[model samples]
Target: MSYSTLPRIPSGWSQSDSQASTSPVSPEEGVVQSVIKIPSTTYLGVESTVAPTPQFERNTADLTSNERAALLASSSSAVAGSAADAPDQWAWRDVGCEARTLGRLSAPITLAASLQILNILVPGMVLGRLGTDAIAASALAMSVASFSAAAPLIGLLSALDTLCSQAATGSSRPGLPGIYLQRCLLLCIASFIPSVILWWNIHPIFIYLRQDPVIAAMAAHYLRYVTFSLFFTLAFESIKKFFIAQGFHHAISLVQVLGTPITLASVYFLAVHPATSIGYVGIPASVAISYALSSLMAFAWLKTYGGSRGWTGLSWEAFRGWGRMARLAVPGAVMVSSEIVALDLLTVATSYLGPTALAAQAIVSMTIQSSGTLLMGLSAVTANRVGNLLGLAQPHRARNAATAALGCGTIVGIVLGVILYSLRGQWSYIFNPDPEVHAIVKRMIPLLASLLALTVITALSLGILRGQGRPKIGAYMNLASFYLVAAPVGFLTLRYTSMGIVGLWLSFFMAVLTSGLGQLVFLLRTNWYDQVLKCEARLAHDGHHEGLMTPENHPSA
Candidate 1:
């Protein structure tokens, strides 16, 4: 849809084209031309909204003349006979565009939180039909399945978030789409084998944990279904991240919502049926079907409502660049993988406490994981925004934006903590109505809430570092935090004290808090803003000196 055109600027605006056309286009041509020069005053507030509709909106209060000039020059291209040409420049009209951009990107976070909220009810439903042991097995299955799928691919998907956002703000280039698609395909292929192996072996692992062989066998069957579904899930996750970073998240959320009711029904029918009764297998089956439906739904939605004939080409050359992108993505995956492993290790600690404790811990962990959805969402936003700033060669603003995002994320996390804490008693009804499990969950709620803020800070810092193309920090931080801090705490406390599962939970909280604090300190100490400038400068120097990249080729080092 065409919006109103920008008004011609009289004082500061200058036409840069040498061959000026005499006549403007007709209405039939569907084009409008107008040049609006971005003043030096506006550049400082460039980080603010393009439109200051919100009270918190501020202009970019720190944009330099060079950046302002580049933006102004870019506006001329917007008027070069196509409304679709560089619509990003139109964002300048809002004056609060940056803030609005941040707000716009939050759609996925909210959606993801809502989805997690729905999953919280799963344990509750299962608790009524299956016993505590069954619930425990299911939880363990989820941890394993999630690790195989979500944890390993986080870096790859997250890279899409950062890179896509950067691509949006900058000029497009040849092979960009191919690179993204290749990366996605590669992730899909790589994720399959581990997922399959985990699916096949998870039951035996649980059996070795001394869980009931029956529950383990059933859980393994369910996990196999989940494993099969993971291929679709990972693809959907990759596409979701890619589109979200490109400022399109609403569709993914819609697909998720649309699939939820069906999934719930599937679980209920499969678990309770006379002939098809699969017991715990029903849960995994429902989850797998849900993901598959959602993936298909997401794909269909994108195809019909999104672009026609999207990403239909092959780029063999881009495959060579996978090593570089994977280099960046691996650290992020490792960082995420380590944290998940810590959480799983804590689960292992709770295993010694018996079925009731394990069931209680699983329920509580699910809730906590659900609550952290907002943190993950904010982290994604921070990564994308920071990456854009770095890509545009504005590191100071990137730092400031990262800082602001952290502040915002922290406040959100605190509020979520309060909400989750208040509802602790109520949450126990989801898995099983057992009084003992309820009591345990209620006691742990406060600790989880207290640690919520810290989780946000840690996640945001990870996002910042990852977006800054320093996934190595994320990897190292996770190693230090989980292996160095969280793991030892879990083992020592569980082994040496009578705290039992509570001790493990406490250690979990301590790990996140300590890790978050450490990440924050590291992030603050780093000169990332200066690093951005240096990167841009180095890229420019390399281009000028070595003739490896030209202005028309790419806007990168």
Candidate 2:
């Protein structure tokens, strides 16, 4: 509820007048954030020698990935402090190295993220056996659940993305990461109340929205039964962040690798089998159980072998930072949930086209969900890699890395597009045996493929902004693209025209295009040399000399 007047730098970023006289960060001043999220990236960028800018003093916990990266990058010039350590000056090989580094870090993060998504996808696949209505109904249930559950979780926990990693730098306050972990876990629980209430009685809302009463009722039933997984999944993610914050980035990947088979098998026994199956209800029940088991195993690790970096057990003090966290968390959520809501509304809108079209939307959405999560993981790595490059004051390399990240993300997107296209014939069958869903999915493949590529490019574009410590720009772009552009396009295209489900995706395409091109042009015009100075200014103002930079803490990847 409190606000203050902060000075503005000539570059338009807020700064403090006092930092105008602060000294530049020396090479040995502080440690850089090592490791990647869930997997660490190799340091390979260089520094700039411009005069330092004045950075504002603020709460480190409230900063996003780019600012945190700037602060850390300014604190240490270790990666490219010498020409010997510098990446081969200005070669295409530089681009290749950046791509490879991004790829290596991206694999584990993508795999683990995909494994978690299987909890949603596998259920849809199993329930698809129950016919098209099941897919349509489950889609509705999940659309609401995602808004209520997944979106909110993403927002509140996004603070931890910056918070825990910043806390772990140099192990200065190991216990702070633990406190953050506890705070995030507690916050997720406290915030789920509204979502749970809505899920418990969402049928009326759906009915009022003109959703088929039968699908609404089925969706409502599935949500009511599957609600148990919400707490466990949130806990699993929080604990995963805890491990990542302390440098055990591989822990969650191990859990996911072990959990995937259990998830697949659970769906078979609890929902798919003729004798053991408990019909539609069993599909979601199995998902809940898989999530529960994953959470339990993650917690067990924390109890037995985890917490070595900074944990000293839970503290009551964590309860106090909700307001501070909320200030950061809510905006992060709004940025993320806007996209989620837009995407879900597309699905919800498709419901009016009947079970056949709704079923197709389900397949398309889930397919994209799993694939898109992978690209999203890649985007996280892009942000961190750029941040690290900036930390070394490597404007040239940071720019190159940013370019390389776009190239890498595009290639991955194209490949996923190919995969989505190639499997267009068979992909729908993975979720449903119906030929009708298959036909609709096939028609949508071309648009879906293009959307995939655009999505990655756009995501990587924003990742550069994040690395540059300017997430608000990306947030604003997202808000405008999704709300002002996509919303009207989608509504009119769907309601006024006969494009059917493809119109929904068309709107998504326009949104990503608008946001992506906007960010791309901005990054191209940016002054990288000044960005390094800004990084130094950020750390100077944050006032940390020996931060807790650890191997485990990075961004959300």
Candidate 3:
């Protein structure tokens, strides 16, 4: 088992004891590589060699043409063994493979992000045209929607980032991805119940919180019109994850691109046309219609052009995996909700400062969100890459993927920070024309830039955690950093100090920094081998009894 003597497993291929000494082959050889197995342990520091299962070898040739192409692309480098044995021997050292994987995942997501930003911006712009009352109402409505409905739903749906990516690489079953999508749909629909109730009663809730009665009533009306689109939005999210997990990233971009103009047109028409009864509520209604159309298009694409290999059609099997899905979904929901709630709390605190302060905060917040889209795309890349490696039972490669993602995040953060810093004084002009708001935004730019860098790190870490099936860890970190650390500092600074809005943003900066550091530590300390085992256990518990390379199935056993 010396490092030099160890066989070179092709990039996407795995090897067992018998194959450990096999020489690397060219892609032309068409060798059907088996899944690699970690050496079994009989006692502390004692290893047992296991032969490859004949069944696995026999089934290798059954891989689909696309699967074969994927393997070939990845096989350009030798697979690295466990990090415990040789930490520096990871396969991601192949700069080509790393770049190809990262680039492939990042490109489409970045494009899709433009559409997402447009989705946010168009509504705000349309409302701004109607008057300050409309602008205030739309802002409040969006905040409430994010906190009460969208964040939780997005969090819950995030579980698919783990389930679908792992299943894509780990399971031999073709129907697993579709089944997971079904489960996600069911979970989202169930969660939508509470969201509906919250949106329906949001007016009273906002009033009770002492928000402006006029804005509260207007926002409530907006939510009422938009509530019908919740299920469609969640469905689109689920389908998007399905595509991303399977390396169909461009399809998502296409869907978003096609939907964006429709979104813009619908919003413009509804908001400007006097004949429309919707009025201010038309902004959300247009958003709803856009989501529905986008989701339908995505579904149609999935069924037709996109590989429907994993989709076995509707089944009762979707209803069967609730327990396991919840293990990831619940924590994911909390992690997402915590962050959104923290931002909303900051919004509330700023409101107390006056309309000018609130307007300034919105411009800054929107800018940060827009600039962070590239990093969010990178986060999705990290989740898929890490999950795929773990699924292949390659802990060292998974670790490398996580490291690469963090490095990428840092580099991207620095670039974005520089851009934000350079544009600090002028960026807010795109959102608001008020000179007072611009002044406050100028004062906040330094803090906002710093927060942007920190957020990029935190977001990527959370993605890594999700990929590793450790959403609960992210949840705990968010709770501590945001609620325990950031919120208190923000409240004290806002109330007891002269820092004003700058103080609130500084607290946010501190919270994001804390979260990023916490996640980085957790990632460094992770037992990736244990994670491999956990993935196996999850696959087994889900009754996917095929394609697993467990210790019990080792030849030594």
Candidate closest to the true structure, highest TM-score: 3
Q: Compute the lDDT of residue 546 as modeled in candidate 1.
A: 24
Model 1 CA deviation exceeding 4 Å by range = 1-100, 147-150, 174-178, 202-204, 272-277, 308-312, 528-557
Q: What is the lDDT of candidate 3?
A: 0.71
Give candidate 1's error at residue 109 in angstroms.
4.0
Off by over 4 Å in 2: 1-79, 82-95, 114-120, 302-307, 383-403, 462-470, 522-557
TM-score of 2: 0.78
Q: How accurate is candidate 2 locally (lDDT)?
A: 0.65
User: What does candidate 1's lDDT look like per residue over 143-163, in tens digits?
Assistant: 776666656765556666555
Q: By lDDT, who's the top model here?
A: 3
The predicted structure with the larger lDDT, 1 or 2, is: 2
Write the residue-wise lDDT of candidate 2 on 1-557 in tens digits: 11111111134432233124233333343422221111122221333222112231123223323223333333222323221223344566656765665555556767787776776677777778787777788888878888777776765665555455434442234476677778777787788888888888888898889888888888899898768766666676666655544444456677877777878888888788888987787876776777678778876776676534457777896787677556546655665676777889888788888888988899888877776666555665566556555554445657777877888777778887887788777777888887887888989998998888788788778667756666566677788999999999999998899998988889988998898887787887786645655554443322243321322232221
- Candidate 2 vs candidate 3: the TM-score winner is 3
Candidates in descending lDDT order: 3, 2, 1
State the C-alpha lDDT per candidate. Answer: 0.59, 0.65, 0.71
Q: Which of candidates 1 and 3 reaches a greater lDDT?
A: 3
> Pairing residues by index, what is the TM-score of model 1?
0.76
